[model samples]
Target: MQETPFCLTFGHILPYSMSDSNTTDFTNPSTFILLGIPGLEKAHVWISIPFCAMYAIAVLGNFTILFIVMIEKSLHGPMYYFLCMLAVTDLVLSTSILPKMLSIFWFNSREINFSACLTQMYFIHCFSGMESGIFLAMALDRYVAICDPLRHSTILTNSVVCKIGLAVVLRGSILVLPFPFLVRRWPYCRTNIIPHSFCEHMAVVKLACSDIRVSSYYSLSVAFCLISLDVFFITVSYIQILRAIFSLRRRDARLKTFGTCGSHLCVILAFYIPILFSFLTHRFGQNVALHFHVLMANAYLLVPPMINPIIYGVRTKQIRDKLLRLFTDKGT
Candidate 1:
């Protein structure tokens, strides 16, 4: 007696036996096929061009930020230390998806081992959460500097910064640690083809043969709880920062104070806006195109990493001066 094959459709698996040799039995498939943006498969080659460019820029830009902060002794403050953490997080986040994504586009390597897929899923979410925590840390640094300038040094000391970094890592890790384990418990006795580029949490969960409400609820809860709290704290910090800026009588002083936060604000918007859009669209926007959601998801991870260093270099006077001096000395 031939075993029945399973087909996954619309987030449910239906068992159906087919005599056709082409219909592969994906029940407990060892490797999953990642269809890189299902509807726009033909355009994957064209899409790879920009994705590749963004990835290159992100790697170079982040490495540049890390190098500058490391070499410039004056930049060894709590703020720059936080910036370094952000840069590292951005690098890990983007790298988690792009290399395999590019391979899927350029080389037609769509199959990813199940274990590898799970690992990818873990790293992407872990680093994403860490990135948000880093943003919150950066916001706190700005708030302290602007609102309590005299005590900023004493408050955000080197030891305190180290502790904050550790906390951010542990928080992100502990929150996202359950993802892979939860996913591993399910039996993926359905079609092992994921429609997006990478192994996203919900995407992989939808392939499971069992009830996915646990995975869905946990993911939603984690996302909402972590992001909401981070955003709330960041908002309060900035509000206090704004109050401090407004309290200064001199217009120039106000401008200077607010200008210091400009880059952090831009980077925060770049990070959060696309992520929120993608998350909401994925969950609620059923009418929206699948390709659009995939593109936005990829964009959120790639864009911030690519442009963060640019925003900082352009908006922060110290970084700009240092970058210019480095280039000038090289040219000479």
Candidate 2:
């Protein structure tokens, strides 16, 4: 949020190398380098155009969905309530990295200040974590709607939904806030160039010149706790969902139910599968998985927001109709 007067990303490399210390405490740097996206094989202008377009579309599209949900009384159902949360999370998620990323790509300015890096990491992880939770809540909503239609209203009550939203906030805030602080507390005397596009925790930690054993342990532990918990819940939910889907005898009824859950299930797989692989690769450090690992990690971040709206737009009649109405309306 700091404007030009407080411009923090105007520096060369750090004075210390990884040889000096195995730890990096968060000392505010003039800028940290981004050694990503730039390496992608494309003309600078070509990549900038597409990346900027994607950022613009991500914001506009997610914001429009949020606005439509807020203004439309008919859209006040639990499904839409969750959808609004998803859209808002998408907007927040993309905003965290896109602007800085686009700026870097366009201006060849990869240097991000230490405080800026920490700030970016905090929200990026927060929204990313929040999205994982929201997806789980969404799957649960689908399950209740499909399997126990009779109890849908009672199970997903107004207060219950509020609690779910609160859980999303608390989950991200409580687990992730301590991380940037811990990183900042460490002393790093190494090159400030980040291997990835954004201030990813693991990547940044690797740059530290001092003993980072505790930080690494706690950070990895926190990551495992959140991601492992998410995967477990999502897997259990889908198992029950599949069991219910298969148990139904009516073909037409089955197809109808599939129509409702298909997109959601697709979204769940799209979002979580890559993330699981990313985590596995990080933990095991298999050299063979390097390229594929980064690819999966990027997809876990970029693909979901891009694909979620498309899935909902194509699969849900209500969402499609609403989008159509917006585009076709005579007055704006």
Candidate 3:
């Protein structure tokens, strides 16, 4: 419910405190206090339960992927290498937010210090950028495998694959690490109340007392460079893949190509679509389009990790058989 400003009366003849005219102070407070849980403060318990459950599932799913990929020697190929890297990134991504988010949802005192906010923001960007790079690696791997099947082994050497993985991690970290520094230099108005569950870069930046133009530009630059490069590279890889598949005489080869690429395409759409939606909504729509934005936020993080294992488990016979045996035998 909306609350009215307080009023005072002196024997039915009241005067507004001239100092209550301090609207400027309220607007430019030293700290932006978050008055959280607007309508359903009483429903916090119910909210907490589901939030905890979802987060638990996210953690477990990603962790399980990492475990299975590591344990099975048959899965030590390039595809599963990328898959495991992605699982690692997924775990980091979810962990960066979920524990703190769970804390806020379950209990009160949702105060996050400036340092903590910056830490969370930095890691979130780092892991996300890494995911993008790994996706590009995956695309490149598929491209080489499909388009150059004669010498796929020689071209995509284990050493070469190791270098590719290293470069992806390094480049991603380099691209995103500067963002936190740019943000930290600003003299924030001490508003700790993040509009979202975690300290999103733009949301936190928007709360700065100083002009965020430079920071915003940096953010936009990173997004444009990483995402555009990822999309362009993926598209180029897939186009070549298509050409290669068409050159084949057998119909099954085309079906095989479609099956392999289709899953990657689905995962790509799952990630980038929600991310782009969030970027646009947060930047342009203000508070108006937030419901969808929030949904997208959850989708971007959870869906990839949740669906990825299923994809591999269903499609890759060895993984399916291994999972079955592992579950059935529970090694004594």
Q: Give the winner by TM-score.
A: 1
lDDT string, candidate 3, 1-332, tens digits:
32111111011221112233322323333332222232344565676576566567656766776788789887778887887888788778877877776665576556676677778888888888888898899999889888887788798888988999999899878988887787777654323344456767876667666677887888889988888789899989988999888988999978877777766777787778878877777567645434355445656766666666566667666667877888889874
User: Which portions of model 3 miss their true places by more than 4 Å?
Assistant: 1-50, 330-332
Flag the better candidate by lDDT, 1 or 2: 1
Best by lDDT: 1
- Residue 94, candidate 1: how far off, in angstroms? 1.1
Candidate 2 lDDT, 107-139, residue by residue in tens: 767678888998988888888888888888888
Error of 2 at 157 (Å): 1.3
C-alpha lDDT (0 to 100) for residue 125 of candidate 1? 94
Ranking by TM-score: 1, 2, 3
Clashes of each: 0, 13, 1
TM-score of each: 0.93, 0.84, 0.83
In candidate 1, where is summed lDDT lowest over 10 consecutive residues?
13-22
Ranked by lDDT from best down, the candidates are 1, 2, 3
Q: Write the per-residue lDDT of candidate 1 for residues 248-292, one digit (tens) a residue.
A: 999999998899999999999999999999999988897787778
RMSD of 2: 6.6
